[model samples]
Target: MNEVFAIADEVAVFRDGAYIGLQRADSMDGDSLISMMVGRELTQLFPERDKPVGKLLMSVRDLALDGVFEGVSFDLH
Candidate 1:
């Protein structure tokens, strides 16, 4: 995780209660770490979308969540 890389000097991966391996946090990336944990090389964690992005379908203005958040606005396309 980002936190591990930020604070730790080395990272150790474990799977199914067994130790996998250890590598320096500075020398490892998220994909590689995940691949080690999963026991496989991850080629495409997120597949590419087939279709191009479309126009805006919805819009939100001045959205609020009680005492949590307020004045939130966004658009979905």
Candidate 2:
């Protein structure tokens, strides 16, 4: 018998009534995770290309989750 492992990277941005999601193959490494986060910009957080890292790292205070399928990921069989 054998066991397989997979790691996923995700970034979700919540809005007034909806949200955006992005995913990439991020492994168990700091540099890889940072690179993947930098690459995927399909949300408001990374909406602008010239947004500085400092701005990007700002505290997203009091963030809450409210959705029909909150915090769920989709996969194909």
Candidate 3:
């Protein structure tokens, strides 16, 4: 119930709607498909981050999680 699911082409990403950290498994499912979105993938595509902006790139990922919890829960068929 706490988990929220989102579709991204052939990938789906589950969000915590609380924490911003992409804890190991949280970033990918069992199919070896990535659980991160295009933007998240772009931000984390590489790890040569030794600059200021690069360090803060993942900072706003909270909105992705926050967007889930901030709204009213709904029912769909």
Candidate 4:
């Protein structure tokens, strides 16, 4: 994304083969790009959950996959 902005003079955004809009590379951000592509404002892109997020939903500690990777870890809360 950074590389695209640095090298491209202009950007043409599209959605489902429909032309959304064209923008200068220097004048765009993630939110604006998403909004343009989806035809919705950033605020409306994600739904608001009624329940608040609570404590640790899941946790992965020192997970390793043989022959592929090792020592991977993460947590979802």
Give the number of the best model, judged by TM-score.
4
Question: What value does the lDDT take at residue 5 in candidate 4?
Answer: 79
- CA lDDT scores, all candidates in order: 0.91, 0.41, 0.40, 0.86
Better of 1 and 2 by TM-score: 1
TM-score attained by model 1: 0.55
Per-residue lDDT of 54 in model 3: 30
**Candidate 3: where is the Cα deviation over 4 Å?**
1-12, 17-32, 35-39, 42-46, 49-77
Model 4: worst 10 consecutive residues (lDDT sum): 1-10
- Candidate 2 local Cα displacement, residue 42, angstroms: 19
TM-score of each: 0.55, 0.19, 0.18, 0.62
lDDT of 3 by residue, 1-77 (tens): 11322432233345555333343444555333332433355436676857554333222322334645543443322
Top lDDT hit: 1
lDDT of 4 by residue, 1-77 (tens): 67777788888988999988889978898778778888899898678988988899899988988999989999899
Segments in model 1 whose C-alpha atoms lie over 4 Å from true places: 44-77
List model 2 lDDT by residue over 1-77, tens digit each. 01111433444434444643444434234443444445543354446667534423333434447763354443322
All predictions: root-mean-square deviation over Cα? 4.3, 15.2, 15.2, 3.5
Judged by lDDT against the true structure, how good is candidate 2? 0.41
Instruction: Kindly give the number of clashing pairs for every candidate.
Output: 0, 0, 0, 0
Write down the TM-score for model 2: 0.19
